[model samples]
Target: MLMRPFWHRRTGRPAHPAAGAPGRPPRGVFPRMGTMTVLPPQIRQQPVERAFHGHVFSDPYEWMRDKDSPEVLAHLAAENEYAESATAHLAELRETIFGEIKDRTQETDLSVPSRRGGWWYFARTVEGGAHQVFCRVPAVSTGDVIADWTPPVVEPGTPMTGEQVLLDANAEAAEHEFYSLGSFDVSEDGELLAWAEDVTGDERFTLRVRDLTTGALLADEIPGTFYGSFLSPDARAVYYTVVDESWRPHQLRRHELGTPLAEDVVVHEETDPGLWLGAGLSADRRWIVVEAMCSEFSEQLIQPVADPSAPLQVVLPRTDRVLYEAEPLLLDGREQILLTHDHDAPNSRISLMDPADLGRPVAEVALRDVVPASDTVRVNGCAVTATHLVVSVRADTTLRVRLLPLAGLGTAAQADPVEPAFAEELYTASVSAAEHDAPVLRLSYTSFTTPPRVYDVFVAGATGDDAALPAEPLLRREATVLGGYDPADYAVERDWATAADGTRIPVSLVRRADLDPAAPAPVLQYAYGSYEHSTDPAFSVSRLSLLDRGVVWAVAHVRGGGELGRTWYEHGKKLHKTNTFTDYVAVTEHLAARPDVDERRILVMGGSAGGLLVGAVLNLAPERYCGALAAVPFVDPLTSILDPSLPLTALEWEEWGNPIEDAHVYRYMRDYSPYENVRALPYPPVLAVTSLNDTRVLYVEPAKWVAALREASTSGEPVLLRCEMAGGHGGASGRYSQWKDTAWEYAWVLDRMGLAGA
Candidate 1:
């Protein structure tokens, strides 16, 4: 499928909302009236700044570390009418839009690897904390039903209540708490069982064995878990990973059946476990792979069972920028294909690497090359054998599934490995992949705007496959797991918005289609003009509420982000970092010129490094935006980067430039440091959200920003604060807890925009 332009171009069709807000939109989606004037630059740039010498930013850094610029009050005062008009209608907007996707029954929880008798199973919690397991066992040799297991009923719904059938009263205490359960492995002869369970949610796990003949526990509690869930491959030995204070994997231990606890010790301890780890076992029980993560991407290391201590070898290592999933191939000759990032671009690439070679002798194949101008290439799925390797690569909006030769994982692979005619098509974000009983590849496809369909096809290996599993229909009566929204629901319109120097900048617009084209609809915009992280087009369902409302949404894919790939990212980083701040402003002006979006209704938002994006954008476009939200923002940029002792502080030097060691880098970061640049003025009403546990984006940064914004902003609009007590950089750990926190920020924004209504 060819990719279409983001905007209405070749189609020559008007982009309109198929459905508006739950309630009436403000004054309909049409252009409204408002007069605008280009203002002078906020920061008084001195001519001496051209040297990149002395204090980096023109603003006071050390003396007024906790202060703000008060001139923002005078700046915002110039655009008073747009703010007042938006405030009048925010209440109604909130009441109408908040309820669309907020309901307990409508919520969902996801975790895979379920337990059942044969192939396929459903793992989920029932009413009252009961754990149910549904399995899809083939009935009558052909009729495979994904139905109930315990009750043995063939209904449209999934199966559950496994404890009742798989175990008796002796095994299951009257009110037994089934802490954990699963189908460990089916075995070569397809007999016997080895599953695991942990009474607690922590890493403590027990490997249990049951006779496919009698279905009973083979041994006592699989001892105490050393680090993570104990894994039992075949009934021979159990393998597991252990984590220390920093949650780093350190050891991989093994235990044989009938062996005394004393001697059955750790078969291997990853020497550089701090930088690497492994636990997943191969189907043939000949290999094991562990994943390792660092400041950058993580790599997977594999060890042969015969030489379990073979020097740490990489199966899928982060060589470039992207992280690839090295899925274990369950064929006669077990192997793995590496998912890698493009070395020269922002896209992702897929290659095959043999786990045997300590990753020294490499075999890399580019599944999808980087699209010259676009940042959209990701590998999805692959099935490898001794003779062939079937791969799934996602680019743009489509998934192309191809079959390559098994030798691709080795230097011996044939030159032309891909089968042109056999390649199949699947939609991106819709398909789900899972291994069946044999070498059958299951393809599950669904779309936010489409229903789900599953396909089980026979992928040829060294030994030819004669029968392919029939395509099955996955009837999901309800709307798909996808939302009727996409990142494209928001538009990117680059235009010239002049700065104090008369330099025009670019801005991206992301708003609901049915908005008043000229009414200055409440807008929530985001940007991150630092680090080479490319903020390309990506889907996120959590942001739909803002887009659903008449409020407009935008992301300033400024210079810092690698949206344009490596070169774009490199240009904005290092000494040229200020371009990030300026690029963010250019985006604001482009969107502000759109009639439906009121300049006064504009709101700036960003987090972490992006927090800096919002902070700078708010100050630069102070007269345009009504409010600002800097989440765990990097306010004290220069100071934070200079302190190597802090966690992530040292790692960010490569991103912000090693200011501590290099004076030139120091001046570059100092120039746009959000905390240092807070001028004395009435700044926009900002809610600075930070987290104490966020080591990446320090809590002090946002805390200082909030304090400064309060002093600088002349507007009585609330400059508030919300600091997550226990959560990490992400803010929330649990699914429900995440939504709760997000709702608070969203509710506040809607109310502030005068959209919160009855």
Candidate 2:
């Protein structure tokens, strides 16, 4: 298996020194590094504005069309130069940091023969980059040599290592830049091979099958506008989903394994406008299920797909009460389906669905919320068995994946309830990785106090039930630098800040415990609170830099996220979108209330959608913060969503609502649209960063937003624009590079908060 390493500051672990860490904390406290650094005067001159009229919607980039405008060309040229510099600087920085880490590390990843049966063809990462080559892991755990792996095979008398092969493959893939291998499927009989890969992160994929025995290409190429492609159980067809022109979700399609690609087929479709698309196929490929999670309700349907275009029977109709989660599994010695769902009540349950009666699953099995962690809710899917399930549940920051029986669950079911398989632990087990011996061994690791590790686990049944899972951890790095640094060294607690509407928003604050409670240090607060996603507890390296420097770091778990469950998300989005920005503002205000932390010491940071929150706040309370770091931000909400021609504009209407067609939604988006609200106001130091190749929240959004703010804001708070020339919506592809980028971004923010190098 390709090994990847991560560096982080864990909350509840022992710390080791760095490869060459120099000094220790003063009096056991990290001294601030910005004792001599100073903020630029231009930052204090930025202006602030709360609202802008509709006429402000005119495209700010229209000036660029005037080629004769030397001003525009000069600006563009400078930006292009800056982009190049960012990449160059990142490469250098990553090399320095990773080199230090590598010196103190042993294994980056390992190749182990796990209990899971899904280990025939595995992948291994090459040495130089974030690329990997496919290889079949030896059937035995190279035990003491567990850290060592037999690289990929090429040809006779060839000594090329896996990394070398992957380097060439990555180079080859770069040539096309449009298609490469994703997941390759070798038939059960080991005679056929099917592979799928897209243009990087975009959902569209290409599926090509080859005769493994003869090393000959078999099926004609199939192009998809969506994700999730797998070979059918019979091995006669390839099935996957497609995104239509309108960006609407379509059904599972089947293509013939032989040449002359089969006709495009739709296995199922949900026509309800109220219901957005959510469909999945069973693991064994016997049934295809369709479901959608609406603003206030959800529904699901299942069908057997012998013929890809065949209509599916109604399974679980639309309902606000019961939420059905799809699980891919084999049951009754056949390809069946297991599910994780919540009933009309708040509780969650598991169910057994037969492939034959997918339209309506008769067996509704309710498992006890055994070892239940209240906030612990499983992510979207389930690990299935003929009649049981292994589930990963989460409550707050703690998570667990347990096994539950299918019979006698909730309704009239006969299956038994399994025991709580695993207890709460740190870091989510790394993506359900590694399978062997009919038992799927999942490597999941997290840090309660130290960096994460790779844990090998056996799914009691679905993936395979190999008890006494042979456990092998992939890699570990010494956090010796953190040995003297303790979470208790700083005071950590939760407090509530009241919003403008008297809504109480909870904020988690961490700072030097010895500092007087009345002393308000430069506080750095982060918030997300949208997309039903929670910014819960996880190990953070940059946060350590803050704590080390005596800067207070806090997390505002405001509404609009599933943090507090579905209700929290619903309360902050939809007609309540304003609640999100408002809640964030409340947290900032509360943190700034301390005497030690002055207005000039407070700064806010967020990325992507969270970028929207920070932008809105800068407009809402522009004077309250000393600086704002919005990375890969989504600022042009109003305009980006109106133009359907834009990549995700049409599809996003479901998330942000269609303002063009619905005046109500339009007004809502307009009220909070950061781009539209940008006015001639003095602002704090604003650093706008983005990735040039980002498909989501196009780089154009930040570029245009920065330009507008530059032309409008009175506060010169250096409206710096830093764009990554070769990255995607994910920021960067390399681990070391990502860490350096984060460190630099944090370093800059520290400078703004008068905490630079401090």
Candidate 3:
């Protein structure tokens, strides 16, 4: 989804006549603009010629790729200084927006507790705290009836009786400049805790073990490990993965307690550079699943938790263009595997397979179809329990959960689907958490206007006797909205935009209900058309500031996302990636045509792969928008994909075809690469946000992009780069710092939309 850099030299003629003659700006020259302290930073160009697919292309701002160079750092700092000076007048607006967000959000809040093992676990955030504190209380008894999900109403600063703090992120983060909790898991006995932390933003975490009984940390420390670590059922061994040179998780290792790091055994090693390896415990806790997968292909291996040193048994061999996930399940006195795969079904289907047949030396296993895939519905995943089977499916770009009786699973019997009832059509309801043996399922529901609500769905009859039984709602916990908030004050609607290919693109919009549709207003549209990640309609407290100010917020459910189904994603990836850009442009045009939206004040924002979306669209139709915000954008796909040494490049080849091997992919990528397509045109105001420590999408992308825009754009509109010196791809580590960043971005958007006073 994003890129890296390489070099060459060109003399005589410039790469693009529109980019101006490649040269350098005087170091000490600071041009003054009206009410601005200084002009934007002018980066010097070092010509780099790259020959690919029998075509030679010249890159001027390739010098920015040297992130460690003093000049590059100075240029980034200078750009930040210029950005601050350019938006100096919006200081009060930023503070006002920040205040509104702070006032509307509950400073001290506790999440709804979910029962796991013998404890009810939840996370609490205190006012002025940088991170959440994970806490749990011992369950009063092990009973079939679900306990109350509603958390006790405790004072802001008071602690609940019998509450034990599992992990205080604030305390852990106090010593590090940047702290990110990658994984936190408690042993089955609940005596030991294993957590991973990334001090830098590189994502390589350090695994640490803590003795919960003594509140003391163990001497075991694993450095340069990846995200999750699964503790053995016996709590004697921990399984973790480590990344390769290109940052792909390649090796799954097992570390025994009180053993040296050198003694750790390699449980599994993925030789394929494209596939990533990971391990996780099954919901039933009977098996440990090791998955090696790329974007299109996946292979799963399972080993019994009772034998930590046992050989892994393959569920199914990896097949090209076929992706499937296997989870262990217990059904009808047998060990079965619940497989959600898109082998023949485009949207995917759920199948049940016996573990005894999984060891057959065959290319594929004959599985019994449970939930057959349809053209309209996409089977997302399934949560299996001893009592019921919860299937999560997406239809019409909305999520819903279906509960099916697990009794007689091995027999050829079908049960009616138990769907959750909701008042809004464009809302999301999902099985948030469920114990493998518990009859109650923790469900989460939310919409564009409604805050998140947690509920315990009690299944009265999990047997065939009561097939029409309804889910009993035991307890509900609605998120606290500090300010006087009402769902009636806002409205959410779904509209369709006809793309150039005659495909209907879904658009979700939210705004104040009182706003007149006939009157023109600023519209902020966001989208991420990559990674099959769905941008569902979810409530946001900070978004209220924009809605209350008469700004309409919308999400363009463009192609390459899982919003609609797998077909939608297939039509917008690799060779068909251009559809993603055209679809977004079509959505922009559709919104502009609406009488309620101001065509001149349209703002586009996205990050990471979505950042690539905004960047590509900005180049495609610069005149359609007033401003664009690209946060950690993957704008240099050509360079990154061309070099396999870069992080995520090889792993992402399936998403964006392997350019190094295919001439077609190389040329196609070169055609739309944002940095390569920069021209001397009247571009709109653009803000590029990046993090210095971001390994996913290197900060060099936005850095070089901003420089190129400054050198090429004739629009006088400011092209600014804001680099977080000590942050990662997601930006700031602390909540307060993240809020401040949001406020700053909101201020920029408001000022551009002529709503600074609002």
lDDT of 1: 0.49
TM-score per candidate, chains pooled: 0.62, 0.74, 0.93
| Model with the higher lDDT, candidate 2 or 3 | 3
State, as a TM-score between 0 and 1, how close model 3 is to the true structure. 0.93
Residue-level lDDT of model 3, residues 159-259, one tens digit each, is: 77888999999998998888988889899899999999998887889999999999999999999998778788889988899988898889999999899
TM-score (C-alpha, index-matched) for candidate 1: 0.62
Q: lDDT for model 3, please.
A: 0.81
Quote the positional error of residue 139 for candidate 3 in Å. Answer: 1.5
User: lDDT of all the models against the reference?
Assistant: 0.49, 0.55, 0.81
- Model 2 residue 21 CA deviation in Å: 23
- Candidate 2 whole-model C-alpha lDDT, 0 to 1: 0.55
Which candidate number would show the highest TM-score if scored against the true structure? Answer: 3
The superposed Cα distance between candidate 3 and the true structure at residue 506, in angstroms, equals: 1.0
Q: What ranking of all candidate models by TM-score puts the best one first?
A: 3, 2, 1
